[model samples]
Target: MAKYNKVVLAYSGGLDTSIIIPWLKENYGCEVICVAGNVGQDAELDGLEERALKTGASKLYIEDIQDEFVNDFVFPTLKAGAKYENYLLGTSFARPPIAKRIVEIAKKEGADAICHGCTGKGNDQVRFELTIKALAPEMPIIAPWRTWELKSRDEEIDYAIAHDVPIKITRETNYSKDMNLWHLSHEGLDLEDPANEPQYAKEGFLEMGVAPEQAPDKPTYITLSFEKGIPVALDGEKMDGVTMIKTLNKLGGENGIGLLDIVENRLVGMKSRGVYETPGGTILYHAHEVLETICLDKMTQHYKQKLALEFADLVYNGQWYTPLREAMSAFVDKTQETVTGEVKLKLYKGNIINAGVTSPYTLYDEEVATFGEDEVYNQADSAGFINLFGLPIKVKALLDQKREQK
Candidate 1:
């Protein structure tokens, strides 16, 4: 067997990772250093450090990466208006940054291999491994679910019980969850069968939004201030990206703002149903669109929409380190140069109503758009413009008619 002197495991303090510490010790006889990343998994990090240490980890690295996540990863996607099939790519973009941090810590600690608790069938294993391949291709990746004898979640639970590793999961609430600043996604459980409807009443399952019934009767007003395409404030208060999202998430969640249920195609070629809570992200996307209406020109906005889709795919597929993503970022950054403005929104019962938008660089001219009269745009000029624009379509239709007559 190839020997590993030490290994850095992407530890979440979850059931799988809780057991992996002992499993690695017993099987490979290698010292395990646990690394737990904060990607907006709020309560998931509570007691994580203590638990990892108690579970026989030689060392632990707890990294607070929320700001970097929102600014570096989340904002760029928001700028692109990228959502994977109407559901925001919340968990999709979080993998690369976490992997980058892991590689950094591994090198500092001189670990021989990096390990993760991700399963063989899941998309995360691919996300985690691909990031490592892109960043540190030389390091060995120790995937327990792929190599170990533990096959089922039940068996893993049994191992946890026998080993006395502290865990929060149970058969009733065994749904797999991944939460972060962007959104919270829930899978497994009854979600495995597409026919079964999710039981929303379950505790610790959907923590982000209020049960639609519990929401307030009145609508809430929110104002987002943007400077060069990045959100700089909420309701006129200057704040960082992390704080802005946190504040909006509270308001949006209270109003039952962001809740998406969809069956999406994974990168590994399988359809999966996920219940997502993206309170702040939903607000941000809407506000960004409102600002873009006033800020971006017609040609730039339309072309960037296509670019945004490609950028979203790259982030979802764990291709964050590639040159194309950087190139896309450059293009997005240029479009956002004039994306400075404020968007007023009315949040009412899970609906976001765009109130008004104002920007110094606005292209909307009242004189040109007025129905009664206009100075800049002559109505007679459109006859020539339409003739040129429709020439190709007219030619195609004429040819089709001629062919039908024949």
Candidate 2:
């Protein structure tokens, strides 16, 4: 008897997923429906419909969710200043919107189960499954990597070959990657060994941009305008969220602005190294941070910085649908109410230099901060303020002195 009547698989048309369609049909005797979410992976979608059908899939749904991804997922994380150990949480937050769309497709198709190609040892499996559980609590979830006969990518390649499944990579060229409008991440292969420096000059090693050494000699300066923490314009020209990010990606990529190499602690209790290229995101984060310096008060800024770490962890661990994340985002949105400003930056060979920043709601009073001649801030008044601020320290020192005399 068939285990499932129908199954909706989150398909990427990659090696693992290409083989999964046939695997599901052969093993479970189920009709496999593939869902590929388009979150800005450009060339990756080419001929995807044909590829899905050729691999024994009954149908394919390529959901265009780029606008939702950037505005709903990326911007909230950006406003929260959530960066997981220097990773902009690019792939971290991207999973929810994709998985949510998959769940919707599953419901629409009346599928018996939802399946994904995520491996058991990685964070992505947790991400996909968590979103599924949150959205469709009763829906059966299938993880092929956990129960399949294939143990490694090499074995998967063999399975693909035996099934005549077309694959885009070979043993020597396979580097696990995830790409969207926000960023591109490269892992596996040479990156598994932290000691090995990435072969950036090698063909296909870098797809988003060139290495920093190969960047243009002259610096590139660009201006960004923000309205309530959301970027609205580039170089004084109004733009939609998608267009602004796309424009920045080109400008930042040309200057080699955003390339990160880190061995970060994954949520699955292990450390893994990966290289990321987040050109537009890098510029946006920097510009927003600079704007906040003049807009947000010291206490709020310090407290938000502490909260940002927690926010980053939640996103990294795939807790996007939880109430805590929603609460934090609400708080972050409140903080951004006055974060309207413009910032100019100089991009020079992977370095982002702050040129200028301005905000109408800026709390900086030049008259109170000037060193030349400042009547607004009474110099003598600081003596009393400092005394009061250091009262606890002074009292502690006095008590220690009295004890020493005894």
Expressed as tens digits, the lDDT of each residue in 1-406 for candidate 2 is 3399999999999888999999999999999999999988999999999989998999999999999999999999999999999999989998999999999999998999999999988999989999999999999998899998999999999999999888888999889999889999999988999999988767678787778888899999999999999999999999988888889999998888899999999998999999999999999999999999999999999999999999999999999999999999999999999999899999999899999999999988888788889677788998999999999999999999999999
Candidate 1 accuracy as TM-score: 0.96
Number of the predicted model whose TM-score against the real structure is largest: 2
- After superposing candidate 1, which stretches have Cα over 4 Å from the reference? 201-204, 396-406
The C-alpha RMSD of each candidate to the native structure, in angstroms, is: 1.6, 1.1
Clash pairs, candidate 1, are none
What's the true lDDT of residue 64 in model 2? 95
Q: List, residue by residue over 1-406, the lDDT tens digit for candidate 1.
A: 5789899999999888999999999988999999988987888889888899888999889999988888888898888888878888888888888988999999999999999999887778888888999889999999989899999888999999998898988977787888888888889878888787766545556788885656899999989999988999988899999998888999999888888888988888989898899999999999999899889889999999888778878878888888999998999999999999999999988899999999988888877778876567778999999999999999999999999999
User: How accurate locally, in lDDT, is each candidate?
Assistant: 0.88, 0.93
Worst 10 residues of 1 by lDDT: 197-206
